[model samples]
Target: MDKPEKGNPADVQMSDPGKKSGKQPVTACLICAAFFGALGSSFIYGYNLSVVNAPALYIKAFYNKTWTERYGQPIAAETTTLLWSITVSIFAIGGLLGALCVPIIIKVLGRKGTLLLNNIFAIIAALLLSLGETAKSFEMLIIGRLIIGVDSGIALSALPMYLGEITPRHIRGSIGQFNSILICLGVFTGQVLGLPELLGQESRWIHLFSFLAVPAVLQLCVLPFLPESPRYLLMERRDEAAAEKAFQRFLGKKDVSQELEEVHAEARAQDNLQAASVLQLLKSPAVRWQLITIIVVMACYQLCGLNAIWYYTNGILSEAGFASNIIPYITLSTGAIETLAAIISGLVIERIGRKPLLIFGFAAMAFFFSLLTVFLNIQDTVSWMPYLSYVCILAVIASFCSGPGGIPFVLTGELFEQSYRPAAFMIAGTVNWLSNFAVGLLFPFIQVS
Candidate 1:
């Protein structure tokens, strides 16, 4: 085996070590700040996607009122469902574009700048969504969703890589888990703000669009102070000393040397791998296999029915036979559960191994999916049956997020050789968002099927 170069764990040779007075212990404040920043990024992703589903109640209200008056005809549930699903999945379509843009964004803007640049898309889309809803144009909502989708894709591709790089190895899992936790936070916050009768009314669907602006502005405003990922600094710019100083400065108390060496080693080693052109990423055995792994992992993670599980909460609530008025409150309960699970998962990411958590989470989800299928199929009609499905589904959601949803993200950051990291990560994101679109589009059909 080839030995790692000094200043590099083994992969990249460009890391610099600035002498430190002493490594401070990782403080709660620092951890919270890192976790919160990462959490905010992931929340942007989850909120942009899941929050829209709640507004379907209002969107459907608008469509029903409009088509009924204009056409003197009632829209079929199937037709309504199809159109709504399209509107929901439109973001996924935008994501494909955003994910594809990751390499150029990272290369030109650097990771932090690329992430901050997404504020334009978020604000513009949010404004459009509000105007469209007020004007009663489905087209405007579609446009807004498409723009939000692009922002979502950008976050999905870059945020995990950002958090993964800045985090200490010993606590990478927990910090990485912050990604999922924040995503859930987004979903939860959206529900809380949107669930009030005033917010959810047909007159206020535009409010949902406005909700997104808060984060977009927050990210843009504070981003000037945040550090760029050391991996990007070291690998792309070949500035090792600056990278080490950054690690010490930002991470502040984590023994960054071992972790720093690993990151440097990983980057440098992959830098030496056969650089494949676009064609070779698809054709070369090693490159192709890695690309395929990234794609398949992303696909499998979504198809496991976790995201659809949350995004369709209102639909799921109706199926579970809950009163319409009370669903969001209950949905918030699940959100709380998810947040607690994420906090625990973050702590365990280091103490427990990644693969074990992945396997356990997957197995638990498969079990819950099976349960949901059976209870829904039997039409069991028991008073508690739908509640059982709801709770089980929440459990599966928690487990999937705690493990697979969170794990694949960190794995993607760590998997690729330096040159292709951006490309490889982007491809995985493309696959994930594409899968998300498919799931959102198919959900209504799946509900009745």
Candidate 2:
């Protein structure tokens, strides 16, 4: 690696103990970028997932009232069910559309730029949802859901890419976990706000969607001051001066010659390659196994039944013989457990490595899920069995967040080289949202069966 010229502005190295430990210090700027970035992006995605649940009856009632006013008759039960299902499941469809747009959008906008523009979807969706009641239009609410889905799709891909690129290799896993942690926090926030005493009531439910603007606006204000991805600037834009400034800002040090050289080396190695398209990525034999691994992992990330838990928290508790009034409070615990587990995972992922945590999480989930089934079946025979089922639910959530909830995102970024990353994420996001759509559309029917 060639060192920067002695008089270069970014050539001054700060005194840091991590130099001796073969690690880099986590900087304030790096932390802010990750926190605010995920706050607006992945947080909204997770919030939307759980936010609809507590307001389900209220939303359905609004649907009915709108139908009655428009048609001079009440909606049929089957049609009501169908409309609600579409409202819940259409997010995935929008996400699929957004995922398809990743390659071109990121190429043009850059990772941070893509995220900034994505807030447009969130803000528009917020307005549509919050004002749908006053407008007397159910379609506005559905459209809003779809638009926000697009926002989430783009954010999911871009935020991980940005986080992965900005952080040093030593702390990459820890920083990447921010995406998952904020998601868990978002789920918990939705649950908290959805309480009847809060925004979950018929009159207050519209406010839930309105809250989306807060983080979006916050990110818009905070993120512009932060640096763009050093790798993106160096590799894609070939703007060495700007990349050096970005590297210095993110690393919180003046001497970034080694970091610059690493990216320069990668760029030289891929000098023959252009940013790949989805078709090209699919056809390339070199990345065949990498593509397969990402696809399988992303598919399982959605298909692993975690969403089912979020979608059916109330029903699950009710089935376990819990009183209706207490189930909402109990539901909050699941989100809390999820957030805690993800935090713990972030702390230890670099030390323990990704594969072990993933294997352990999946195995533990299987065990607890089976135990939950047994307890659910036997709850009627014993007074204590329902509590056991509750414990099992918590265990399953903890198991999931410990590894499987977050590692897939980290792996998607890690598995591919710079040129392939955008296309790779696009493919992974496609599988993810498709599987998510399948689960959201089919899970109710499957549960009934």
Candidate 3:
């Protein structure tokens, strides 16, 4: 494609980041596409968000109130605690493998293909869980979750990278904001169905795991249709004409020749530095600081133990002394509160800025977890205390939704130069997922102690 004379209309500078990325296609059609973008990864994040709570109840039932099950058998009280720890932490353990594989998947598969393949893992996991009914094998259930963790770990890092990279820059903040929205969507999906009012009527715990497959299937189908990341097409693959064409198509303009050249020029300068190795990432001060910041921010996001509540929502309610029958309702309420808080967050982001929101978010989170310790101790004496604990738990989730949950990936996508964004985010996100696995998988032990 020939470069347009320097003064092309599409060559003009964009004031809003959203406009820069792709805003002109804002009719009813593009809006639906945006929703599909949101829908794409909801389950990828949501499956992990909701899987933990319901199973813990059955595990508890197996070993009595004073104990918990291990490897499908009842265990002593001390071992019950260890058993639960293993069950939860296994998600993290599985994540270690997935995390290691992230760069490979994204690098080899390109952004879109890796995610589509990741969903295939989700389907197999659901099938394995459904098969658990016939075999009565707890191992299959844990292994199934481990596979999901592999997929989830990859998605947690890659989904936002994919979303952040592909969305209109102007709306990046809001769409990036949707990262948690979809995560909470998953939490909501799992919590709603897991509600004892619904599941209590029948033995349907399998329904929770089985239902997780639906979103994966949806993403699996839709992913092939959506445009692949323009950056990937142009930068990595060097399809100059196609990249410019994609950029123009995305912006809803035709004369993007200068923008096309800019894309090549930018990727060209950075492309030489694609000398990314684990050592290069570790040794370069700029890259290293970015990696550290990404990992720390992501780790802190999970350390609040949000997934503990999300994955094990029912278990959390039960521990606080909510009746097993009522836990799902409480979990759903958490989802509602999270949704409201996110809306308010979308409003406040422009005023608050990212760093301030993140710092305050983490500080508030540390305080809330401390409050959890106090509430758990009080659960022995005051029945009302459990309800307060539930309220506090939701408040913490709100803080996460409004703040840290969104910022880490957004900053990550921004901080690294375009050349390194994919690889850098891949590493940072792997850390995030592994940490989520740690906090979630070991949450039973963390809480018991």
Candidate 4:
């Protein structure tokens, strides 16, 4: 195909009066596609992250109640602690398992298919959680969390891949950042719903766990109407007609020839190439640097103590001298700050580039964590110390949202060519979940020590 002339219809269609060159204008279809895609996927991952935190005491009591009922004796504190740890950590373990399955699922089902099928995990998780209390089975809640973890794991990998495949090249970064926005929304929504007036109660706390299904059901209902990725249709399936239709629907315009041609050229270049597996990726020298970069960045994203702070924010705040009743409100405020920072980062990240935000975010987090430590140690001695600790924690949260929190998902799509991307996400997702599991499982022991 020849390039469109300067005044050609294709050229005119591609450029808006105020739009940047090579960038697609934001359309209603794109917004709906992105919102529904992330709503049931990455959003759930964020929701689940903070949801369990508010109901910790109630859930622990339920665990003990079920254990004692089953064994005809009161559950020991150590046993309850062990059981609770398993409950919290199993989600990440399940996430690791989900990440491991990405290559096969995406290859066989395609990106959209994988997401559609993945909704089953969410439904199952919700059912198990809603029934856990009624059945007097603590194991049900554990299993439900694990299933939701698997759902989240697949979403973390697949949603970004789908978003990347479907969006235009120039706007991809901004659109991709929307995943983090949805996750922020999910976390904030979870925190709000977990408040005492909602489902965060001694007797009604089970609703918080069951509410995971709402987004999944919405996604399941709406997904059939959205287009499958044009890139996936063209590159993987070699279905040009379908890919053209997909591009048209996604762009909300008829002239998708330029965009379609770009995807076609990329697909043609890799005509006979096969996707690399996880082991193959590690052993291949050609892509070793790319693989290592993703691994290191993903490790930093998870192991930077963000999850530890999030999972146990109340405890951290209590130690910082915040009263118990106000901790929920403070936790809600952090989510708002995170979402706002991510929005600002999305606006600027494309202009300033990813590396700078990442650097500033990580450096700022380190500085604030150190300050937080000092504040915690001397809060009783200094009248203004507790306020300093609050500022430090909020700053850490803001720094994370600005760069490290969302940049990695964007980078996974950017750093690798199409053929190597699945394998990269597979390895990176596994490392991320494993690191998360380590934090969730071991943080309690670390705190105890």
Candidate 5:
């Protein structure tokens, strides 16, 4: 590992308190890039996670109806369960595939280009899913889920890289939280729209998937006007002038000489190393601990059981002794709490820093998860126990969003230099999607047992 040069602008800005006061303001272009980028990216991932929950029964019914028309017999219970599992789990499979593609895609397209291109998957997925009922093909819905998962897989990697590179280091963590915040917002939006008064009805469930197109279209319209990542330009393309212009737009400043010099110093430090492949990244001792940290954090991010909550909110509420009629409304609270907690985390992350928040969040989650288990086990004996169980669930959600929900993505970008970043995110995305697949596929069985 090469040490930063003495008085390197990047190192000075990071180490010196006085220099922090001179950090550039967050520009409108930067905000739009982060907002619209996430709108088209992680938002779709979160929406798809929860949207299917409200429409699960309807989608299953559609599956059965399609099977019966073709086979002259209704789908078997076992078969329906299997198909539903595939429908839910296949997203992770697609995500895994997308993660595998990230290194190549990001290298070729750059972060912004990759995000813009990813919207095609979202648009196509929306079409397949929204029109699945009209087409009388449940397979289309399954395929759509897979495609949108690819969109998420790519977005999760590319969006973070773009945001991390574009922002001044002073506000990087806060800007990175856009990914987590929009995801919560997406989950909340899905929950709100999935209500019976909206599109949750059997007749209207198709419209839930149609809503995927709105964010994709919004990003398509807005993101083109924004700049590509300055770090990517300067480090990879060696286009100093273009990188300077991008920094100016993102930082809302005319003089980006310090920023340019920082990237130049980093580029010189790397000695013109090419963007590394996943295999090369893994083989290098330089990033061993960084890679390990990413793997563990990302695995924990998915396997800590948040997706299980999002995927089966209704079922979890039912098990907590909530009435079937009230479960949907109760589920909405989880999304709301998650969004609120993530917003708060974004506000304080730079001040509080990442490690403390992560430790506190995970510790609080463990406590709440244990408490919720006790409350659920005794809910039948006491009227208030179920409400306590609900509170526990909300607490777990808050704990997660407070840190673990967002910081891993930020860390993935922070830990690696430009050469290793794409590969680093690819590895993180792989663990993330694989763990997501395990939860989506196995959680129902776990809950049953």
Candidate 6:
């Protein structure tokens, strides 16, 4: 690897770390870009995640209807279980494929271009799902889910990388958390939309799947107008002039010399190394801890049983003797708690630092889980025990969204420089989706067993 060109104006390193250039106000354009990009990508991911929960019964009914119409007989329970499991778990399989594709796709298309192209997956998924019932094909729903899973996998990797590169470092954690916040918002929106009076009806369930296209279309229209990442242009593509213009546009100011210099120094730091292949990345001593941190964080992300809790919270509520009709309202509260936690986390993350939040949040989750166990075990003995179980559930959601739920994505971007980030994300994303797949496929069986 050759040294970064040193004679350019971008090469002048600043002398004092504390004497940082004052940050310009975050511009409307930057917010719009991040917002729409997240809406099309992360929001769709959250929507798909919880939206399926609301319509599970309706969709299972449709599946039975389709199987009977096609085979001239009602579907057996065993086969129905298998088909539903496949439909849910295949999304993670597609996500794994998408994560594997990230390095090549981003390298070829650039960050903004890849996000624009990712919307194609969302659109195609919406179309397939919208038409699945009209065509009477449960297979179409399964295939559509697989496609959107790919879309989510790409977004999970791309959006954080894109957000980190574009935003100023001092505020990166705050803004990066917007990815998780939007995900909570998407889940809330999906839950509200999937209510009985809304789109979760037997005849209207297809529309719930189709609604994801609205944001995808909005992103497609608006994203092209936003600038590509300045760091990506300067560090990866070596386009100094273009990177300068992008920085100016992002900051809404002409004087981007200091920022450009910082970017140049980072690029020069990586000049000795080639872009790492997956095998080489795993073997490299220099990035060993960074890679381990990412893998561990992702493992915690799924294996913490947060998704499993979300999948069964309503069932838990019902078993605790809550009415079936109020489950949607209670589920809505979970999303609200998560959204509030994400908002508070965003506000304080920079001040508290990432490690403390991760430690505290995980610790809090364990405590809550313990309390939940006690409450669950004693619910029949105490009148207030069920309410305590409910509080424990909310506390778990709050603890999670405050740290473990969102920080891993932020960490994945922060741990690596430009050189190793894409590959690192690929590995982390594969871990994440595979873990999600495991939960989706096995949780019901685990509960039964």
Candidate with the greatest lDDT versus the true structure: 5
The C-alpha local distance difference test score for the whole of candidate 5 amounts to 0.89
Find the 10 residues in a row with the least total lDDT in model 2. 2-11
Inter-residue clash pairs, candidate 2: none
Stretches of candidate 4 exceeding 4 Å from the true structure: 1-23
Per-residue lDDT of model 5, residues 264-373, tens digit only = 87788777687788898898877788888889999999999989999989888888888999888999999999999999999999899999999999999999999988
List, residue by residue over 225-260, the lDDT tens digit for candidate 4.
888888888888889999999988888788878787
Q: Against the unseen true structure, what C-alpha lDDT does each candidate score?
A: 0.73, 0.88, 0.67, 0.85, 0.89, 0.85
lDDT for model 3: 0.67
Query: Lowest summed-lDDT stretch of 10 residues in model 4?
Result: 2-11
RMSD to true structure for each model, in Å: 4.2, 4.8, 5.4, 4.5, 2.0, 3.4
Against the hidden reference, what TM-scores do the models get? 0.87, 0.94, 0.85, 0.94, 0.96, 0.94
Candidate maximizing TM-score: 5
Report the lDDT tens digits of candidate 1 across residue range 1-449: 43322212432332332223223356554354455455436777778756776777778777777778778998788778887888888888998889888878878787777778877888888889888756757778888889988887888788777776776555556677777788878877777766766476666767877877887777676666767777778777777776777677666644567646666666655766643344545554555555666677789888887777677888887877788888878888877777777777877876777778888988898888888888776556677777777878788878886778677887777665556567777778878888988898898787777
Estimate, for each residue in 235-339, the C-alpha lDDT of model 3 and write its tens digit: 777776766665555556677675566556666556556737665566566556667777788778777677777766766677788886666666778888777
lDDT of 2 by residue, 1-449 (tens): 32221211111232232463246577899999999999999999989889888888888899999999999999998788778888888988989988888788999989899999999999999999999999999999999999999999999999999999898776778999999999999999989999988997878999999999999999999999998999999889989999999989898789988778878777776789888888988987777888888899899889988887786678778889999888889999999999999999999998899999999999999999899888888889998899999999999999999999999999888878887889999999999999999988887777666
Q: Which candidate do you rate higher for lDDT, 2 or 6?
A: 2
Error of 4 at 235 (Å): 1.0
TM-score for candidate 4, please give it.
0.94
Q: Looking at model 6, which ten-residue stretch has the lowest summed lDDT? A: 2-11
Between the candidate structures 2 and 5, which one is better when assessed by lDDT? 5
User: What's the true lDDT of residue 148 in model 4?
Assistant: 93
Clashes of each: 15, 0, 11, 0, 0, 0
lDDT of 5 at 15: 38
lDDT of 4: 0.85
